[model samples]
Target chain A: MSNKTITIDDIEVPFEEGQTIMDAALAAEIYIPHLCHKPGLSPHGSCKLCTVDVDGRAVSACTLPAAEGQRIDNNTPALNEVRKTITQMLFIEGNHLCPSCEKSGDCTLQAMAYHLGMLDGHFPQFYPQRELDASHPTLVLDRDRCILCELCVRASREYDGKDVFAISGRNTNRQLIVNSATGRLADSDIETDDMAAHICPVGAILIKDHGYEIPIGRRTFDLHSVAESDLGEIKLSNVRHHDE
Target chain B: MSKLRVGTTSLAGCFGCHMSFLDMDERIVGLLEHIEFTRSPINDIKHCEPCDIGLIEGGLCNADNVHVLQEFRENCKILIAVGACAINGGVPAMRNHFTLKQCLEEAFIDGIGVDNPHIPNDVEIPLLLSKVHPIHEVVKVDYYLPGCPPPADAFVKILTDLLEGREPSLPNEMLHYD
Candidate 1:
């Protein structure tokens, strides 16, 4: 580890140098609210939900590279206000449908709402009409409930190289698309093992084979908030566990 | 002119795959050394012409989206489905449970519709694509990559191998998504 330390809000933090801000924060036991942010996945600031005050400007901790002497304050009042705005934007942008959402207690947005104390949307709702494609043997789409976080799309495009998923339209009207023009999930080239389905934070998309099968408590949504869960114990164990 | 011109296009995907290409960092300049990027986000070309490789990101969900896919097929000698969305219908395939009418009505004309107009029964408006599909279904794809977009290293390995006209030796059985 390089002898370099970065400061976040008067707190001097040390990292291995080149470690992402989110990674460093998580290592130092600081919580950064995120949905698409995963250890195995590349950090893209698409969600805009992880924005924290760094030198008085809102920057995503996941993407913003770490530098020396950078002051970070993720728990400030100003940070909460920013988070609230982002949560409201996500809430009104799509039909979140929290009451019926499978990812209720364990969702990134729900936890962010709790963290920022956001109750309702301040912006007017833009209920874009999307479809529910469940023809695939594995995944299902509840487009109405999508938050346009682009996690799935990124997982497919950047991580998978299939780019089998995409965001159609512009701005608030954007929506998820599968394959090329075929539009049928069965017809698309997506495989059962693709990480795209696992990346969706909301019910807008789900792995059909796994739904209603985990009995209630075993699903990730039922477990805990991403912030509380941290780096993800399951992934760690699966990686270099003694059993392996 | 180089025999292997290339065009990279994004359909309904997040731009992450393209970013991943950039994630290759300075290695890209070496890639740029050989092939040509005809139509890309970096380039402003709208329609794609014939090329050596068509690197497609995102899946298809709309009528116009299909047209673009067809264009890439017409233009590229070797078309590749570059992400999960193009591989197994990805996450967007989840929405096929509902009909096109329902999706459109819910998005625009339904009681919940917002700024979009309810173009009810207009011939001018393009009809919805039948279903969300993986790239191979709509058109024959020469190769399929099955990551969300696939790790950047995976991409680098595949592209370098492809450029050499040899089978890419990146993922083995364990790496296959299954």
Candidate 2:
């Protein structure tokens, strides 16, 4: 853990040689909002979740590993405002029907909203037309609920050893296709044996017979809060598979 | 339970669930007490015929997979989609980016394809589904056990519950819906 020490919000902290700025902040029990990134993952630097100001420069913390004696300030009012706006944009970007979303209590995006005190999604919802593929006996992909976090996509490519999935298209019109052309995962060449599908963090991908498997009384979401999940030992990088 | 005939298949997958099943370890000998496996690695590679429970892993890809899934559907009393691939088209479904014709051209006929192509006797590759589909798309799934190969405990839970004729209990931490 020997490296440069720096002050964030007037608190003195020591940085490990290769640890990222965000990791250090988190280690000190500080919270920063982010998406498109998870622990145990090759830092995407995609979602600006761990963004913080390093000597007045806004930067992503996950990709930028730690160095010596650098001053960082994450508690700026202006930065907090920007983070809220980013959260709003994400909410409206997808058809995140929070009231009905399966991840309503457990979703990271949802948790961010609460941490930031966002009462509404704040932007016009973009209702993308999507189909429901119940063709697969057990799993169903409801494209309408997808946020395009690309977690499942990465899980497939990296750990599954089955390169059965990928993201297609560029920006707004981007969609997830299964085997070849359609949204019907029934046709996807992906084998049922792979573990990628379970990595999806949203309802875009769901397993049958599992929903409502445990009643509301025994659920993980109501039992924990986003802030609580980020602190102490339970705070984890990848919430999908392996436990840390 | 009359010695139940069980069959397990892997289409295109990492073979984790199979390993997980094997991870049932010594308890597997206990499972062997109840099940008479027909087609599996522990046995010999045989296409699934009529069986009590047909546990399928991976999604349908290539020509052989479709036929085998169909065979299992027709013969098996209960068809279970096991693991991520079997449930949600998992990861391999990413290829829907290109047209099949384009994909074939790139993989086979085009220069990106194998240089000295070993032209095969079998021209019938299971028609690539227009896109990836979960197993239930082709046939009815009596039960679906999803996990990334599902956790080993998940397998034991689902299996033992079935054997006990009680509703299976998933791990409290395993995310079920989202």
Candidate 3:
């Protein structure tokens, strides 16, 4: 560990020389709400859920490098309110019917909303007519629930070494597209065991025949809040990796 | 103090929230000590009277639902949008992505095993809205209880808090979307 340190919400947090604010904060066991970020993946600050105030400037924590003596505000009420609104935007932007969704209890987006105490979708629902890709033999892509986090896009490209997914279009017209000739997941080279198959933070991409396997009350976010559960999973995975 | 008058209704919902409300079971005997039911299915009341609290389940999908919600909002001092449907246009809102004409066609004419193949457009039938809307979209909602059907303890907790003249706040455990 380097001697360099930064203060998040006035609490001293040590960081290595090259670590981003999110990296340093997570290492220090501080919970900063995020949706598009995963530890090993390259930071894509598209979601803006992890926006934090650094010396009165709001910036995405995942992309911002940690500097010495920086005063960063991670969990302020005003910032949380902004985050809540962003989460609501994500909800209304897509058809996130949490009650009927198979990913309800285990979805990061839903968990994040609950963690933020979001009671309703504050904006009008766009209710966009998106297509569902059930063409895959053992996987399904429901665009209705996608938040466009690009986690699967990064995971497939970086870890799986297959650029099977990419986002197409601009702004509201933007959509996730497949890399195959037919523009369907079944036509792509993706498999059930691929990192992209399991990397979605929302219910957009899901494995077939395994939905609702975990009972409602016993599911991931049901047992623990998103903050605790997400951090705990990361830490636990880190411990397992070290043992290996 | 007089018993607080309360009304409950289900529009396009399955009444699962009401089932969860009744899941309070014997505790409702305790609740009855403080509140009385009006314009609810429990009493088969057709119209809402002026009340202290009104708990509405389901979203507005038809003209009748809209009219009922507006009336319900008018009669209650504090209106609580109960369950996911009432709060965010839950499962029924899935139809929102398709045109009402397509939906009607699919359900009545195009769908398999439909012996009678015509969309209902009788005078007795309420007009279907182009989109399903959460209660708040149609009327002012004082509070929201979110869940597919919110848990029984959540209902009890919100009601208890409101009864004690406190702002209703649910614990993290009680707050869930499913």
What is the lDDT, from 0 to 100, of the residue A67 in candidate 2?
66
Top candidate on lDDT is 3
Order candidates by lDDT, high to low.
Answer: 3, 1, 2
Q: Ranking under DockQ, best-scoring first?
A: 3, 2, 1
Model 1 DockQ vs. reference: 0.01
Per-candidate RMSD, Å: 21.3, 17.7, 2.5
Local accuracy of candidate 2 as per-residue lDDT tens digits, B50-135: 78788888876665677788898888887878876676555554444456566666676664537865433355545565555557
lDDT of 1: 0.68
DockQ of each: 0.01, 0.01, 0.84
- Identify the runs in model 2 with alpha carbons over 4 angstroms from their true place: A179-183, A189-195, A216-218, A231-244, B1-178
Where does model 3 sit among the CAPRI classes?
Answer: high
Model 1 Cα lDDT, one tens digit per residue, B1-178:
4646888887766766787777878887888877778888878788787788898887787787688889999989888777656654545654565677777677777655376566566777656675665566677787765455566776677778888889755443112221
TM-score of chain B of each: 0.82, 0.82, 0.98
TM-score for each predicted model, relative to the true structure: 0.53, 0.52, 0.96
Judged by TM-score relative to the true structure, which candidate is superior, 1 or 2? 1
In model 2, how well does chain A match by TM-score?
A: 0.82
Interface RMSD (C-alpha) of each candidate?
A: 17.1, 12.5, 0.9
Candidate ranking under TM-score, highest first, comes to: 3, 1, 2
